[model samples]
Target: MKVYISGLYSGTSPQPGIGLSRSLRIAYPDATLVGVEYSNRSSGIHWLGFDELWLQRPWEELDLPAYGQLITELLDGGALWISGTDLEALWLASVFPDGHANLLSPPAVGLSRITKPGVEAHKGLPLQIPPFVSTDHSDWDLHAFCRKHDWRVWLKGPYYEAVRTKSWDQFEAVRSALAKVWSTQRLFLQAHVSGYEESVMLAAYKGELLGCVSMRKRELTEDGKTWAGDVTEVPEAFAASLREIIRDINWSGGAELEMIKDPEGQRWLLEWNPRFPAWVHGATIAGCNLPAMLVEAATGIPAEKTTAQSEEFTRVVLEVPVRARYPLPPLPEPYAG
Candidate 1:
């Protein structure tokens, strides 16, 4: 089987994509991985074992037709695209529909709900998001949210890139940077909710829960990505609440809810990941293998429940020398069911 994966760029690293490929290999040993890098400059293009590495069109150039043609080529090659980024996931959820149903990911509705404005509008609900405003209507109106929250606001791009801006000047700088990256998309101003970060990863189908695992971030880098973390228990109360939100949204695939625990011990939903998180390898090793589960669902194959591993995983940086190899056949998987 051929599986196409994207996320070649995940904030100064490509571990996210490589991690997915590694997980996929663990789940299905015989599967061939088709890595999609938006740029040839992506360093992970060197990480070994890709059956094929295709440089995809830049995100800014992906219109319906361009994206559709790309999909056709992939499907014709018998490759299933596993989204690496929310942008790609949204496009797949919107375009392919049943073709990629095994991903069991959120539909367009669920995807839309995770956006900055969507999170802002749903504040005070089960997730209790912090106050936020988009610059859609007016910049002046967004500043009001800053005054109301009186916190350092995060100037965020539509998909990625978030910069903490306490004053107007810094906001402008990040805004200008985002414009160059994600043109034609709106920028959002989010109230900085003070708290330590935690995340819950889940795999569900048709509004019913399969299983889930949660974690607390112990160490983080400047970009808010978890560097070191330990697996924690999933709170029963929080599980019940997250289930309701999933049912309400009719979510159909893997998702990660990033949260922040405030001084009062209340957790606010900082972000909703419609697809698997970058640290998903941690989840897979923990026994809640979302990639394997997703592949099972997508392929319509029945599989028994698997056990989880309890522990922590630290993100480590390393390098490998590329070696020359002749043309290779499809990758191998042990349980490519």
Candidate 2:
């Protein structure tokens, strides 16, 4: 079987494509692997031995007709595709209202409910949603809110970006900077929850929870992305709640629920990513291959639920020898007088 994976970049802030590609390779060594990316700067394009590489137009450059045509060409041979980034998956869902069999991604209808401003309204999840105020509300008392949280709060953009601010001045500065950078005023503030970080990674298909793995962050990059983690067992109650969530949304594909567990053991839902987390390959090494299970579920063969064996994973920088495989571009001819 052939597989197409997107988001193949790796760095301080890595993407999930390379991890998924590696996990899929471990499971199906002979299967054709195709790496899909939007930029030549994606480092994984050359390091990983993918059977094929496809570069496409950036997200903003493609319209519905163009995207539909791209999908048609990619899945022409009944190949399965798993989006490795949340934005691309959300965009695909928007463009293809009916969804595609060969594409594995969360349904668009339920995405908003699990994302930022909308997640606050999502009911039935066994977690606390931190109180937040949107910038659109000019009447909000910023000082009072900061004082309530003991001068600690997280400033967040509508889609992706967060900064922790402890004082009124810091809050305003961060708010202004994020607004300018993201080019929007739709920012929000959530009181910081003092706790340890953890994430639940799971795969679902047509409302059925196929498999899940819970892990706690042990090391993080400067940007707070997971750099090392250890797999932890899911409590039965927590597992049941996860099942209910999948069934409630009729979610299909992989997802990661990021949360913070406080000293009182209360879990606060921080974010719900529509696609797999970047550390998914760690789960593969720990004996739970979620990428493989996702592919299997998409193709009608449901794999058994998998739990990770007791294991830990960490990332380290490495250098690989680079060689030019394709012919180099011709040198410009000398200018004639």
Candidate 3:
């Protein structure tokens, strides 16, 4: 069987898809791994080591008719798409929910029920959402918010890009740049509570929790990503909350609950990553092999034992090879999003 995996950027950089390709291939050695990217030169194009690579139109330039044809071809050829980037995941869920066979994921609209500003609006779920206000980032009023709450605040974009700013100037600069990066004019001005960051990564199907691995950050890169972390078997109560959240959403995909634990030792759910995060390989090494299990759940293989081995990791940057395919086509316009 074959599947298309988006976000194949080389893993050495602080980018998405770092661990995805490696982990997925390790889990399923027989399947054809097709890599999808907007540009043929994307580091992932060379380093993904996929069986095939397909260049795509820029997200903004993607004509609906053309994308539909591409999807039809993949489906006819028996390739199911499993998203790796937040953008692709959102697009698949929102734009083409029933277009192909999906193993794990909620419909795009259902995903928005929890991630969008109003968690209370999502019925049947009791979730503690962080206080946040949406802004267009045009008339940014950094001082007023800082005066009301402390100087700490998290500036985020619609789908990706999150930065914690400690000063008015820093807030303005970071917010301005990230807005363009994520291709959204709006931003989420969120209350930044002081706490240790933790993540609970899971694989589910039809709201059923197939497997889970929780981790507490041991160290972070200067850019504020999980650089090193240790796996911790989550308490049953917390695990129950995770299951309830998924069941309520009927979520059928890979997801992560990012949280912050305060000095009082209470955790606050920070944000929900719609797809697997960069550090997903940690789950496989931890004995869950989530990506593999994800494929299994999708393919109906008798599931492997989802064991929680005590695994810890130190994420390190490394180099990858770059090669060009024959009969190359002209590169697409650079993506501004």
Identify the leading candidate in terms of lDDT.
2
- Candidate-wise lDDT, in order: 0.70, 0.79, 0.69
The order by descending TM-score is 2, 3, 1
- The true-versus-predicted C-alpha distance at residue 162 of model 1, in Å, is 2.2
RMSD of each: 7.8, 4.6, 4.8
Candidate 2 regions off by >4 Å? 118-122, 166-184, 301-310, 323-337
**Total backbone collisions, model 3:** 5
Of candidates 3 and 2, the better by TM-score? 2
Q: Model 1, range 1-337, lDDT digits (tens) per residue?
A: 7777777664543336777777777777777787877765566666675778877666676576776776867666555666777767777776755434434456776666677645632443456767677767576776677777774788887655678888777777778888877774488888888888989888777666666789888888876788878876687876777677777766776777788889998878767777778787877666667776766666665444545666787778777554244232346777856
Model 2: per-residue Cα lDDT over 64-182, one tens digit each? 58776878776666988888887788777886655677778877765866768448324666788888878776635767777888977898876567889887788889988998867
Q: Which stretches of candidate 3 lie over 4 Å from their true place?
A: 11-18, 98-100, 116-127, 136-142, 169-186, 302-310, 326-337
What ordering of candidates by lDDT runs from best to worst?
2, 1, 3
lDDT tens readout by residue for model 3, 198-281: 988887776677778889889987767788888767678767776786776667767777888888877677777777777887
TM-score of candidate 2 on Cα atoms, chains taken together: 0.87
Task: Estimate the TM-score of every prediction.
Answer: 0.81, 0.87, 0.82
